[model samples]
Target: MTAAAACDTAALTAHLVARGLTASPAGVEIHPLAGGVSNDVVAVRAPGLDAVVKQALGRLRVAEEWLADPARLDTEGRALRLAGRIAPGSAPEVFDLSDGYLVIERAPDSWVPWKQQLLEGTADPAVAGRLGSVLGAYQRATADRDDVLREFGDVTAFGQLRVDPFHRTIAARHPDLAEAIGHTVDVMAASRVCLVHGDYTPKNVLVDPDGERLWVIDWEVAHVGDPTFDPAWTIGHLLLKTVHRPAAGAGFAAAGRAFLTAFTESIAGALPIDPAQLVRQTGCLLLARVDGKSPADYLTADERPRVRDLARRLLIDPPETITDAWELLA
Candidate 1:
């Protein structure tokens, strides 16, 4: 490895050795994995073990102010553990964790981020369907699992994560967004309950090179409450991504719709939420554009005309069908 790469790896290996994941003189080898906007992940090879070590830094390696979140790393271990329980195959076992570090089983280095595949025009929607199916199982299994899901209950404070930063901070700086976003407090208060992956976009998923199973990662903002948490998130990102890359986006949405439709059907009997509850959740998803902390900076100036237009129609005046809401994202 190069010196800069070593800079991100050796310190952690030493930390792990002290924690008993590896022996002090075991001749460990480390390979740093780089990509994504907010993490430092590395592959570690030791005499008795092979593992992927990851850490979340407070500031993004990139200079985007909206990407910064100091509290994110602390939520990693809990989210991964919960995800492993619900969909064991989707995540590697969590071998160890501390302050800002996470260690899990090492998968093939050939893993491709679902986003890059979509951009390159090769992502499979059927795999996304399986993702949706498994996520539905996760919700059903964990909904009342000894209140474990409920312990991570701060998702109700979504107005803070989803609303204030965009409205009070970023969108407030722009005159165009100012009027529509002004006094947006009441817009979020109603539907602020549910266990949501708060950042469940495609950028957070990885597909094994064979184009088979999927792995969903990055759960710093995950919490319990809404059934629409995962689906609405998937829908909105689908709309945004599709608008950006027409062909791949189209494929993603078709697969997403299939996944979500199946997921809803599977969990219909188990969801504690009613129509009013889901409607409220969908509305909360709409405000995600104007009031969300990170906002949707993933879109371009040309795309915002469409995204913002959809956010307003949906947030301010919603349609009856959840499918109708998806078109805004498209």
Candidate 2:
């Protein structure tokens, strides 16, 4: 199938009208949402519709020449529906999925990216806990389900967007850690446990300040694979924030604890995999952000080595649990 045209206000407006999605397409306003690199996401407002339309890009908007199948939009549409069932209101509701584009529910206009909140140092424990609960519920509910596995079994997109750009790229750059990173990749490939939100970072989450609603957006990389990847991304990102601002380390550490505690509690049993696996994944994730295709823009030149050193230590001598990983921040 041919890929759709790149998403822009004018093209999207015509697409919506052509699909008979709105009678007053003239009044339908589309504004591009910033912060994503792999797709064009826009907020749409019409006479009776308030939604977000997303179309995948084969070549991601990063400095590196990263590429993935745009058909992953179909995977996202399916994942959103399933996640909405597992953890209602935690993900965007899919409305239409076709022609290599997706239309889905939009968070309230007032809602902001959770990344913004963390960057500003709010570090609300409640928000952190809720994120843990949602992720935990999604993983626990779908763990080892054959039907889910059948639908989301593919990990090609995950490889392109995550494993390759992250694990492989970093391994090449840091050959000293190649053996350990290779094992992590092998273990992840061998797993068929649950639905992994491959991009479960703060930037993908939207929240309302009133403490009322939270939406985990961007499921384009969702796949059924290693369950540890989601929590690793979350904890890894919090660790990044801690590294970014050591002055607010205490609050960030508290949020990480709350997140991990809620995740384990939501499982309501022994952790599915060894806790050490979480640490290992977090270590790899840390290395990826600092040296992989997309380094964090927030960190200063002096801070990059700090992050690199932390990642190296984590890989060589990993902490036993996610909570223990925070001590390395010092």
Candidate 3:
């Protein structure tokens, strides 16, 4: 193996040994786990055993200057357990994890971050629909548990992520965009309560090897907020794909529409929410990218002038219909 890959294996084996999951290094093998912005991951292999080990770092790998929260590491485990509880196998099973190291059963297949797949036109719309259902069901199951969620009126954490950095910085940097962003700030600050995967986006999901099942990963950003928040958050990424990758934009838009139709239809009458509100939330979700602290992925990239246009439009002049807005992918 290349020296870098070998080093990754050795490092992870040492970590697993320290975690007491593996006592010896002789049988264990490691493969570098690829993807994501905030974590370092390695896949560990042994006879009749397969799992992934993830660790949190102070800075992102792609841009070593950006700092991130270690407390969010603890959130991953909480999210995994909560997801499994809501849907028996919506997430992979974890054998053991601590503040720094997390070990969980590895899905035995090559998978693409749903963002990459969507950008490539290979991601399935059915999976998007399932994602909606899974998220919706999870929210409905926890909606009434006030004891489970201590706060409903505040968004200190949300402000830290969506407001402080992403949205606020843009307005501060671009004076012309201030008025549009100001409006989004008010909408985000007025959020409702429901279980939210704060970072609900395509990059965090993996399709089962057989392509029949879908799995959502990364729960470090889970919070209790408006019920339709996750849908708006996810659909925003699909909207992003449409703007950034011309070839895959059509597929991404199709998935967003299908996912929304399925999500709203599945929860019809059962939900107390209005679809228009969700659409408004989506515009706010898009604005949060510009006005919030954790900016969308496109903001960091050098190319794609259209994404800048879309972001401005979503914030400055959002479409009246989610479907009409979704067609931007075409």
* Model 3 C-alpha lDDT per residue in residues 70-96, reported as the tens digit of each score: 666666777688789888877888878
- What lDDT does the true structure give each of the candidates? 0.63, 0.86, 0.68
Error of 1 at 193 (Å): 6.4
Give the CA lDDT, 0 to 100, for residue 322 in model 3. Answer: 69
* Total backbone collisions, model 1: 12
Per-candidate TM-score against the hidden true structure: 0.77, 0.95, 0.81
Per-residue error (Å), model 3, residue 245: 4.1
lDDT of 1 by residue, 35-74 (tens): 4556787778887778887776555553335444545555
Full-model lDDT, candidate 3: 0.68
Write down the lDDT that model 1 would get: 0.63
Stretches of candidate 1 exceeding 4 Å from the true structure: 1-8, 60-74, 144-146, 155-194, 272-298, 325-330
- The model with the greatest TM-score is 2
Best by lDDT: 2
Better of 2 and 3 by lDDT: 2
Question: In model 3, which runs have C-alpha deviations exceeding 4 angstroms?
Answer: 1-15, 18-20, 62-65, 150-162, 245-250, 268-303, 327-330
